[model samples]
Target chain A: METLFYIAAAVTLLATLRVITHVHAVHALLYLVVALIALSLIFYLLGAEFAAALEIIIYGGAIMVLFIFVVMLLGPLAVEQERTWLTPGAWVGPSILALVLLGEVGYLIVAGDLPAISIQEPRQKAVSIALFGPYIIGVELASMLLLPGLIGAYHLGRRLSSEAR
Target chain B: MSLQDLIVLTPILNLGIFCLVTMLAIAFRRNHARIAAFAFVACLLTLATLPWVASATPRAVTALLIVDRYALLYMGIVLCTTMMVIGLSYHYLHIQFRERDGIEEYYLLLLLATFGGLVLTVSVHFVSFFLGLELLGLSLCSLIGYVRTRRHPMEAAVKYLLLSISASAILLFGMALLYFESGSMTFRGVGMVVKQVQAVPGLWLGGVVLVFIGIALKLGLAPFHMWIPDVYQGAPAPITAYIATVSKGALVALLLRFVTDIGALELPSLVHLFSLLAVVSMVVGNVLALFQQNVKRLLAYSSIAHLGYLLVALLAGGPTAAEAVTFYVIVYCAMTLGSFGVVTAYSREAGDAEQFEDYRGLFWTRPWLAAMLALSLLSLAGIPVTAGFIGKFYAIAAGVDAGLWWLVLALIGNSVVSLYYYLRLVVTLFGDKPASATTPQGLAIESPQTSGWMAICSLGLVASIILIIGIYPEPLMELIRTSVSNLLMVAQQKP
Candidate 1:
């Protein structure tokens, strides 16, 4: 199980790197969907089955499709457009920094001083009770957060469509 | 959940419902004036409910929110400032937008932003804080770019959105780290860990510093202040006022709560870090302000310095810290809104009258607006006879009491350095009009429109408040003392 978790984590990291480095938006979206799926696999390995399912369903499936649609709507990019900005200088520094971070994290895990994850699969009933009980205000506040977000999106989108006309 | 909880939550509840109702009213019929009037009245009603909410006295409505005098005081300030913004936005939008354009949604976004600020003041849990911050941020993105046809506002909106998203990500990561260390999300839970522990972990300190960096970026402190000038310059005038005041003020309140809860001042490392941020922010903010040609950008830099001064009070953490911070925030909001309100009043159909050239001889042309702007600039400079002076005095006093000599000196020096540009603008207001200068398009000199009058009256109200507080600070100080006591009591009770 631990080996599988590592495998999933490696796949997720590779997919994320591809998503960041890919020149084309469509390819990036595909890689991002792959990363999300691998992330859900890691979640499942951690015993958060509900979160894993939700992650795949909401992020990997629904959001990926939306992203693809938006990219399609934006049309094809000029071939060298992003390449001009994505020179080696841009990625080299960040990649080296990321490598250092990865090494540090790997060292910490191998040191075996950190506590192991307690794998408790949260029941759907328990999740609902927690969400509706003490966290109910947060739920309500989240709704408020989405309300303006939707309005603002629709507002900006309407203006864009009108401008296109 | 319970009757008392609902009652304690009335101020937020009332505003939240009004936001929805206002949205519906716009959908039912998009009458700009009617909707603006409805939002203004809704905010007024929310302000009215605060006293009742206060009567419920220090109730934890949920694990997420704690309604106390500290939250209520900031809420009152937020609501009042929003009302002023709504009033100022009315004519500005009316003249800016065509009749076919939907201006009513601006009010909806404005009210939602206010609701977000209100939620932030009372948030005790990370969930509520993140939600509130996002709500405010998302709404602000649209509001900043409401003039979508213009390129600058759009660019400004995108800049603010990208930077703000990164900052929020850092904040979330910090919260996750802190939760990992303490196994808790509530402020009180973290406070308990801090209280019980003998030696603090490095992970916890890392989380705290990351969180402060995120918030300092939001507050536009020195090193993290790249976005302020562009965002401030590009946003519409009234919305600029909103960003400068309510958005940042709520964060200050939250920072105070978190710092006090953890007894962060007791740690020398944190004290040194804060003092460093304070001094750098003051010097950087003031120094940058010295060269700004645009009024909005100038105020933007001045605001950075002002926040740095506020950090001195925050660093001075003791019985007087919260009071000093609160008083300074109120004074900051009043002066900021007053100056931005003047900008809104004089803003033309083309764009905001942000250039120093636009204000040249403004006193000769428009005395009332000029006087208000002059007074606000004086306050921003911490000149005598304005609330900014008294606010600075309190901050200095708190710093002295805490023995933060260098931070206090930096603050005083920055205030002196800040006066050059502020007075430069004041001189521009009274300076000679150029012979070649054409009447800048739509200079608000045609006639006294009703909406314009309403905007001017609000500016007058802000100016009067500044003077009243400056001249008679005792009553305001008394109020702030009580509120700070309530805050300290709550912080103590948590552990």
Candidate 2:
């Protein structure tokens, strides 16, 4: 099980690197989706099934799809016409930061001091209860926040249709 | 059912009812501007209810939110700023849209965002904080692109969306790590874990750093401030005002509450990190502002510097520091609203007259608008006889009390650098210009003839309050002392 965890982590890291280096926006997004899915699978192996599920559902499925849709809508032609690489300074700074983080994570795993995964039955019911009980007000507040976005989108559609005339 | 509960939720209820009534008015009437005016009036009434509702007795409505004087004061600031922004929006959107199709939606978003900000000020759990922050963020994206007809607005919205998504993801990941380590999600629960746990290890520190990064991105501090200039320049003036005043104010309130409740002052490492960020933001923000030709971008960088100053008070980490931070937020909100109001009024007719040169001879042509703009700029530059000066003095005093001499020196240096650009705008407004040049394209050089009675009145009222507060700050100081005292008491309460 530990060996499998290491392999999955290695695969996730490789996929993330590819996502960053890919020239095409669509390719980058696809690589990101794969990296995220692999990362979630690793989480599942670590006994966080609920978190893994959310990772796949929200990040891999919903958010990645949004990115792909945007890229496609903007078209591959636009991507090809635009600059492929960001500023060298941007690449260098983030790379250095990422390396520092990677070193820290590596030190923890190597020291054998990382907390052992305590596999308990996933508390799916408890999570939902918490969401709807003490967290009900926050859920409602989030919905209110989204109300504006929905209204704004509707208004945009109406304006576009009228302008089509 | 309890008085404390009612006291905590009155402003939120007011906002809900305001949004509903405004929607009904919009459905019945074709006049977009009138609906906006009604909404503004509603916000004013809501602001009036806050002082009466704030309790001396602290209470929590649930495990999630605390009702105290601290939250009440911040809510009042949010509502008051929203009132001014709504009044400005009525004229600003009308001039931009020409034919109003969905102007009512803008007010709805503003109210919702204000509600979110109020929630953030009182939140005691990560769950509530995330919800509030996202609500504030999502509404802002829409508001930034409120003028969909323009290319720059759409571009700005897209940039804001992408960056905010990344920030939220980082924030969530940090929350996950924190929950895993502490075995809890509530602030108090985490504080207990921090106290009992023997060794924190690297993952814990990483999570804390990621959380700070996410917050820094939202605050538009240096290193994470790339989005501010573009978004501020592209968005409609009223929306920009909302982003500057309410959004940033709410974040400060939340940070203060989180630190106080979680006993972050005990952590020397965290204090060091915040102090470093404060110094960097002050120097970088001021230097960037000195070179900006666009007025909106200038203010954006200035805001970054202002946030650094607020951080000085926050890092001071005493009851006095908390009082100073609250007082500074109130004064900052008033000054920013008035400045943005001037921009909205003049620029609506001048078609995004944000360029420094666009304001040449403004004092000769439109003395009232120019004068208000001058006063606001002076206030922002920390001139004597303005609220900005009093706020800065308080912040410096708090920093001195905390022995943050280095931060005080950095803040003073930045204030000096900021004065040059702020006065440039003032000089341009009163300077002489050639009379033969045709108006620049996309520049709204000519002031509109319409009677902007309400907008002007709101600006005048806020400016006068700023002046009064600057001259005699004892009243506001006392109020702030009461609020901070109440906050500390609630924070010390055992769960």
Candidate 3:
């Protein structure tokens, strides 16, 4: 479990680095998808299995598809813009910042102040129970929260309710 | 969950059902009046559920929501004002139904935003607050730009979206760090943890400051108030009123609740941080309004000053301060909604009823509208006969009681400065119209009889409330005092 966690962390870091460095918007989005999946794997290792599946389905799958759709909508102009934006010189700044974060993580791990307690992985049943039981108010409120976004998207996009996918 | 839990959560749950019902209503019929009626009924039903919910007071539904008296009072205030604003908006939306796209969604967004405001007032957990903030933000983004073809509304919505996205990021990051520091996501849990520690940790302080920044950004306080005037000028007057009142009021209530719970006012450094924010907001907000030609922008600056006054009272930190803050919020909402109600009535699609020129000779043309607008402005300026004056006096009293002399002095000075602008607006309304102003190119000011009287009636209702409160504030003051005391009962009783 510990080994899996470390590998997921490393993949997350590497994928995130690639996400920022990639010039093409499509490529960056792909890297983001990889990073999101890796982070979800870490979530699974820690015990939030429901959250892990959601991270994959929502962020990795649905949101990434939306990003691709937008990139396609932008068409050739976006790629042309990105090519100028992601020069070799531009890489130096983000790379330095990423490396600094990596160093900080390394220090935190090595300082021995970080204790690794064995994480108990709860089953899907318990997670669902917790969500639907006492915490059902949160579930209810979250749905209420999303409705406005749904309406806003429909309104601003000027799409008819009948035409909604 | 048990039946009792369901009963305790009825207010917010009622709104949740209303949102779904409104969605279904939209699908069933696209008529403006039907949708507005649906929204109005939903709002009233939700408000009526409050007393039922309050009967189950001090109930904590899970770890996220707390339905206490403070929450109930604030929720009632937010919902009532929202209902009034929605009525004022009916004629505005109905008139523009042809020109505006998705006209039915206006009521949907308003209800959603109201839900967000109510959630905010009761949120004891970071998750609930964040969800509420985003819900409010998303609805407002579309509502601000409901007239998509217009340039100013589009610009304003975009500005709101971009700035608030960053603000939410900072706020979330800060919440994460605070969670890391205390291993808690609830305010009470974090407060308990912090109370136990002898010396406050630096990381915790940093996170708190970030949270403050996020809140100040939303509240349109000084140093973070760049978006206020533009957004106010651009959005429709009713929405501007909604944003100014419902959006910021809930956040202020939340802030006060959190600070009181955490005993944040006791920390000298945090005190200084708040005092600094309060002083800067007062000075900058009042000084800037002195030069404004547009009434919306002028009101926007004055709103900043009003928030500053609340902060000063908040900084005072006592039973009196809490009561003052609550009473002031109700009065402030009434005046603001009334003033903007007048604006919404006269506004046309060709041009906004925004400039100083638009208001010139308003007294002669529409005496009732002019009377409401002027009285509201005078109330805002804190004249002796208006509710705003009593609100200001209470705020100053709270500050002085706490020995926050600097903030109190600044409050007095800013009130004087604000008077100049408010009086100027009043004088301009009574001034004779120039020939050039009477024949503007784009604007076609609707004749009073042709224009919507719904908005005028709403404005009249709000203005009367202000006057009533101004004359006899003891009843309102006593009510706030008791509720605030009820709110502090939990912490005080245990200790």
Task: Tell me each candidate's i-RMS in Å.
Answer: 2.4, 2.2, 4.0
Predicted candidate 3 versus true structure: per-residue lDDT over A1-165, tens digit per residue? 476468668878987898888776655665677678778767766667677798989898896678767757777698886676557654554455445435544654577453253356556788799788867767777888788888888888876443358
Q: Write the per-residue lDDT of candidate 2 for residues A6-125, one digit (tens) a residue.
A: 866776787689778877665566557667776876786677878889998999788666865675676757566334434463355335434543554465568755336757744889
Q: After superposition, how far is residue B371 of candidate 3 from its true place, in Å?
A: 1.2
lDDT of 2: 0.80
Task: Flag regions of model 1 displaced more than 4 Å.
Answer: A71-118, A160-165, B436-451
Q: lDDT tens digits, residues A16-132, model 1?
A: 898899876655666677678778766766768789799989997896678656645655673354455456754554355345435544754687443245477668899999999
Cα lDDT tens digits, model 1, B1-495, are: 889999998999999999999988998998988999999999999999998778887988778999999999999999999999998999899888764477889999999999999999999888998899898999999999888877889899999999889999999888988998988998778767767889988898888888888888888888899999999999999999999999999989999998888778888999989888888889988898899999999999999899999999989887798999999999999999999999888887777889898888888778888999999999988888889999999999999998989888888888889989999999999998655435655453542333376797799899999999989999988888888799999888833
Model 1: clashing residue pairs?
A: none
DockQ of each: 0.45, 0.34, 0.42
What class would a CAPRI assessor give candidate 3's docking? acceptable
lDDT of 2 by residue, B235-330 (tens): 888888889999999998998888887777778888898988898888888888888889889898889889999999889988988988998898
The clash number for model 1 is 0
Residue by residue across B217-305, what tens digits does model 3's lDDT show?
99988999999999999998899999999998898888888888767887899999999999999998999999999999999999998
**Better-scoring candidate (TM-score), 1 or 2:** 1
Candidate 3 has an fnat equal to 0.74
TM-score of chain B of each: 0.97, 0.95, 0.97
RMSD value for candidate 3? 5.1
* Local error of candidate 2 at residue A95 (angstroms): 30
